[model samples]
Target: MNTTHPAKDLQVLAESLASVAKVTKNLDVLIFGAGLGGLAMLEVLSQSEHVSIHSIIDISEDAPAFQLAHELGVNTSTDSSAELESFRGDIIIDVTGDASLRSKLIAFKREHQVELISAKSAKLLFDMANQELRSERTIETQNSRLSLLDCMLEITLQLESRPPIHDITSRSFADIHSHVHAISGLALIFDKQSKAPQCVGAIGENAPDCSEIESCQSCNGIILDACSRLSQKERYKLFKPSIQIKCQAIENCYNVALPLWQDTRLSGVLLFDIQAPLSKEQKTTLKMASVHLNMTFKTLDHFQQLEEMAIFDALTGVFNRRKFDMQLHQEVSRIKRMKNGTLTCGFIDLDDFKQINDTYGHQTGDLVLKHIATSIESCIRDYDLCARYGGDEFVILLPSDDAMQGSCLERIGMRILEKVANFDLVNAPEIKTSVSIGLVTQSGETAHAETLLKKADEALYEAKKSGKGCLRIFADEQFHYTPSKE
Candidate 1:
C-alpha cells in the first residue's frame, strides 16, 4: 500500500537529477556578426557570471566591432559556418538581423543538439545590457566633472596667489595648456596709444617670440588679419563675449579669441587653438579663466607703463643717459663676440641753443627738443639706439657689419640735416636751430664705449670750430669736417 520496493529509490534518483539540472553551468557563447549589437552582446556575455563568449564571426575584417574584437584578443572569423560547425558551442547568438541566416541556424539547431538564438532575441539581450551600461556611464561622467572642477579650483587659487604679472600669465597659460586640448596659443595685450596688439605669452609649436612686449610687432599682422575678417556686427558681439575663428590650416581646430576689457577699453586678447564647438563645461571654464587673464594683463600693463617712465627721458620721450649707458654696454659686448665688428658713435650738440632759449621761453625750448627727438626717431633704424645724452646734447649708437663701408652713417647724417632744416612749429617764428654732429667709426672688436664717446666728443668740438651746421667724421684719430652748403 505504501509503494514499497524500488519505486521509492526511483523517486529519490529523479529528485537528485532535477537538483543537478538546476545548478547553472558556464556556457561557451559564439557571437555571429561583429556589429554594434553583436559586440554589445559579446561584452555582456563575457562579463556575465554564468556565461562566457569564446569567439566572434563577421564577413568583413574591417568592421568597427571586428577591430574591437581583435583588440580584445577574442578569436574571430570571416566565415560564420566554419566557426558554427567547428566550435560546437553551448550557444550561438545571431545579431546580424539576417533572416536567411536565422532560418538556416534554426534548421541547424534542429539537427544538432546545440542551442541557437535568433537576431530578435539577441536584440533584447543587447538592449538590457545597454541600459545597465548607460547607468554606469552616467555615474562616471559625473565623477569626471567633479574631478575637473577640483582641478579648476586649484588653478584659480594658483592664479590668485599674487605673483609677478608675467609669472601669473605664464602659470595661467601652462595650466590651460595642460587642461585644454589645443595645438597652439598666443596671449596678447593691447597698446591703446599705438592701437597695436602686443604678444605677452605663447605656447606650443610655431609660437611667436616676443620677449619685449612693447616694441615687438610680430603678432600685429596676425591680429590685424583676424580683425579685418570680423564684421561690425561680429565686432559688437566681442563686447559681450569671445569669438571663435576657424583656422583652415589646422583641421578641426578653432582659434578662440577672448576679449579682455577694463572700463570699456579692450585691454588685451587671450587667443588659443582648440577643437571647435566646445562643451558647456569647457566654455564656462574658458570664460572664467579669461576674466582672470584680463585682470592680470591690466595689472601688467600698468607696471610696464611705470617702467617706461623710469627708463625714458621725461621731455624728449627718448632713452635717458642711464639707459643709453646700459644699451652701449650691451652693444659693445655683442660687437666683441663678432669676428670683425664696426661700431659708429655720433655726438650731436644743438648749435646756438642757448641763444634760442634766451629768445624763446623754456616752453619753446622744450618744444624744440621734442621736435628734434621726433626727427632723430624718424631717421634711425629700429635696432639703432638714440638717447638724450644730456641737456641740448644727444648720442646715437650705430652697429654695422665689417662690410658696411660707412655709407649708412653718411645717409643718416644727411637725413637728420634735412629733417632739422624743414622743422616747423606752431605759434613760433622762423627761428632756425642747427646741429653740429661728430661721428667716430671704429673698426675691430677692441673699441670700448668710453673711447668711442671721447673721440666723438673731440670731433664735435672740431665741427663746432669749422662752422655752425656741419658734420665731422672722425677716423684713425683724425677729424674730417664736411660743411653743409645750405
Candidate 2:
C-alpha cells in the first residue's frame, strides 16, 4: 500500500487484514520489541479490527517501551525477543535493533520453510503498514507537494542529466498521446550486464513487474539505432554528438533516462516513464532537482576526501591538531553526562624541536611528524579521533574505565602510556616518537565545558614538566580556575 491516498491505503490494509482474518486465528499480533516503532505499529493495529495483540515482548521488564505498551491496555511480557515468532500470525513485525535476533529469525524461517501460496492480501497489509510507519518519521523532513505532473517533470530532468539512477524502469514508460496527469510510476537502472534496466527503486504503482532487467522495454519495438549507441565502444567515442537525440528509451513511450555512478566510473543508467507530457512549472522542479543533485555529488566527494585527510597531519598530511581538540571536548562531555563513559587527554612535545630543525633539518623533522601521525591513527578506533596538536607536539584522547572510583582520568592515563609510548612507531620503529601527556577528567560537579578544558591543559603542562614522555593529572579534581594551556 505505497499509496498517496490515505483512505485507499487504509481500505487496502483493511482488506488484507480481512483476507487473513479466516486463518489469522487467535489474532494476536506480537511485537518483538516494544520500542517507539513497535508501539507505533501496535497503535495502528489496535485500530484495525482483524487482529488482537498476543503480547509485546522485550528483554527489559522495566524498559520504557513495555510501560508504554501496557498503558495502551495491551498485553505485555518480559521475555527475550525469540518467543514472539512462534505465535500465530500471517505476518510478524520485528522492531528490535538486535542483530542476533535477526539471525535467529532468518534461521527459523529457513528451517520451517514457511511459504504461503496465497499471501497477496497478507503481504499487502504488511507492506502498507511498514510504509505508513516509515512515512510518519518523514513528517519533519519533506514538504514536497508530490503530483503526477511533478513526477513527469522530475523524470524528464533525470533522463536529461543522465544521472546515475537509483530507481526507475523503462517498462513503466508509457507512450504519451496527449498531456497525461496523476499516474503512478517506477524508475529502473541497468548496468553493462543488464539487458534492460531493472526496477531497483520506485515511488508508486509499479512493482514485482521488474523482477528482472530484460523486462525493461517500451514494446516489442525498440529503436535499434538508439540501442546500439549504448555499446561501450560507442559510448566512449562521443556517441553523444549524434546519438544524444536518437539514442534514448521508448520512442513512442514517455520516459526519461539517467546514468549511475560509482567513484569515477559509470555503473548504469535509469529510465522513467511518466506516461504524459509535463507542464513547464513541474519541469522547473526537475531543473531544481538537477542543481540539488549536483550539490549532493560534490558534497559526497568532498567528504570522502576530508575523511581520508582527517587521518593525517594537515600541514604534513599527518594527524593534525584539529582532531585532538575535537576528541578532547567529546570525551570530556561524555564523562560529564554519564559515569560509564570516561576519558583522558594528553599533549606531547618533541624534545627540542627547534634544535632538531636547526641541526637535523626541518625535512627530517617533517618525516618524523608523519611517522608519529601514522602510529597514533593505527592505534585508535574508528570511533576514536586523534590529531597533531601543532609543531612537533601531538595529542591523544583515550577512553578508560573508572577503575579507581572517581579518578577515571588516571585509568585513561595508564592506557595511553602503554598504547603510544610503548608501541612501535611508523617509520622510525626503533628510535620511536615519544610523548608527554597531561590527562584530566571531570567526574563530579565539574560539568562546565570551560572547566573541563582548562583542567585538561593544566594536566598536560604538568606532564611536560615531570620529564617528557610521562603522564600526569591535576592532584585535585576541582581545579575550576585553572588557566588554559594551549
Candidate 3:
C-alpha cells in the first residue's frame, strides 16, 4: 500500500497542466509597438486560429510591422494612449524592447486585468500556447476574407455600369452604410468657383437633409466653424485636395469624411456615421468607393456640358430653334392629354430691325437683340419657356388653365416694352427699338404646334399693318394697336 501511494504526485501534476490548457484557449491579443520583433511575434501568433489579434497600437503607421498586421486583417491605430485606455484583452504583448513601453504596459497591468507578456517571456511559452489554443477558427477567418473580396468586386462592377451620377452616389452611400452598419451617410459636391455644396445623396434617418439642414444656420455653422479653425497640419492634409474630417463631437457620433478630388480640383466630400471608429480595412474600402464616385461625377458633368451646347442658343443663352421645336411638340402633346388648359403662343418681331441695322452698325443691332432677349426672359414665369425663333424674332409659350383670359400675356408684353425702353446702353446711345407682339390661344385637344405658330405670326403681321410698336391678338376678342408716346 505504501508503494502505491508514492506515484500519487504524478496524477496531481496532470490536473494542474489541464487547468493551464483551458486558460490558453481563445485569447484576445492587443500587441504594442509594431517593430521588427513585434511583427515576428504577430506572424507566429497569427498561425494560432484560436487567438484573435484584436488590434495593434503603434505610433508608426508606415512601419513594416504595422503593414503586416493590416495585411493580416488586424485593426490598427496611431492613438496608442487612447487605445490602451479602453482595450481589454486576455493577453497584451510588448515586443518593442523599449524600456518606456514595457514600463507603460506594466503600469497598465496594475489597473486592468490582463496577462502581460514580454518578448522574452513570449518566446519561452509561445509553442505551448499555440498547441493549447488550436481551433477551427481558421475557416471563419478565410470566410471573412472571401466576404470582403466579394464586396469590393460588387461595388466596382456597379460603378462601371454608368448609372446617373446621383443614383451612383446614392447607391454607394447605401452600400457603405450596410456593410459598416452605420446609422447614416451623405455625399456632397460643390461648385469649384462658388464652393456652394450640393448634396448628391443621403441615406438613413439621421442623414442630413441638405435643403433643410443648410437652411438652419446652427447646424451648418458647426461645419463651417470647423473649416475655419483648421490647423497648419490639418490644412496640409487638405493640400492634397482631400482630408478625412473627423467630427466626433459635432453631432455626438463617430463620423468619417473623405474629400473627393478630380485631378487637382476639389469635387466634393463623402461622409458617413460609424458607431465605432473605422478600422484600417474599412478606411481602404471607403476610399475605394470615393474614387469611383468622383469618376461618376466627371462623366455626368461632361455629358451635361455637351447637352447645354446642343440645346442652348449660342448668342442669347436661351433655347435655340431646334430645342424650341421639340419642346413645342411636347407641349402640344401634353395639352391633348390634359382635361383642361389653354396653350398660348406669342410671336415677337423687332420693329424696324433692318432699318436699325442700316442706320447703326451691326454691332449695335446685336446689342438691341440682346436687350430684347434679356427683357423677355425677365418677364416670363419660371415654368414658361422662351426661345430665339429666328433673326429679330422670338417665341414665348404660356400654358394656362383658361383660354378666355389673356391678362398675364398683356402684363408680360407691357413689362417687356417698359424694360427695353428704360434700358440705357452706354455704347449705343442712338439705339431705340420696340417689339410688335402677336398672341394666339389654343384650347382644342386636336390643335397642332404649327397651327398655333401660324396664327401668332398672322396676328404679328396685322400688328405691323396697323403701325410699329403694338400688341395684337388673333382670338375672338381682338387687340388694337396703340402707338407709344415719345
Cα lDDT, all candidates: 0.69, 0.50, 0.67
Candidate 3: worst-modelled 10 consecutive residues by lDDT = 232-241
Per-residue lDDT tens digits for candidate 1, residues 1-486, read: 324345454454345334434654666778888888777777766666666677888888876577777677778888877877787656778878777787878787778756666566566556757787778867765665565556546655664444554455555666665455557776666667975866667777665455543343433555655654443222211321333322322212226755555545665555667666665545655655665566555665666677788779989999988888888888887787888788888988887888878988899998888888888889998988889999999988888767345456767887887786666776776888678888988765666988988899998888888887788888766766576635
Candidate 3 C-alpha lDDT tens digits along 20-96:
35777677878877777677677778877777888887778786778888788888888878878778767787766
Q: Estimate each model's TM-score.
A: 0.51, 0.41, 0.59
What does the lDDT come to for candidate 3?
Answer: 0.67
lDDT-based ranking, best first? 1, 3, 2
What is the C-alpha lDDT profile of model 2 across 1-486, one tens digit per residue? 323465554565576456766554545555666666566566667766666766777776775567667777887776544454455455445667566776665665466532221123333454676687658645422333244336445655555344433432232233111122323433434354644544554333333244432443443124233444443222111222232211232222325433333344444433334433545433443444333333444444565577768765655564566665665566666666666555545565555557646766677677666655665566655665666777777666656545223355445445544444554435445544456566554453354446655666776677666665566665455421222222
Model 3 clashing residue pairs (backbone) = none
**lDDT for 245 (candidate 3):** 30
Which model, 2 or 3, shows the larger lDDT? Answer: 3
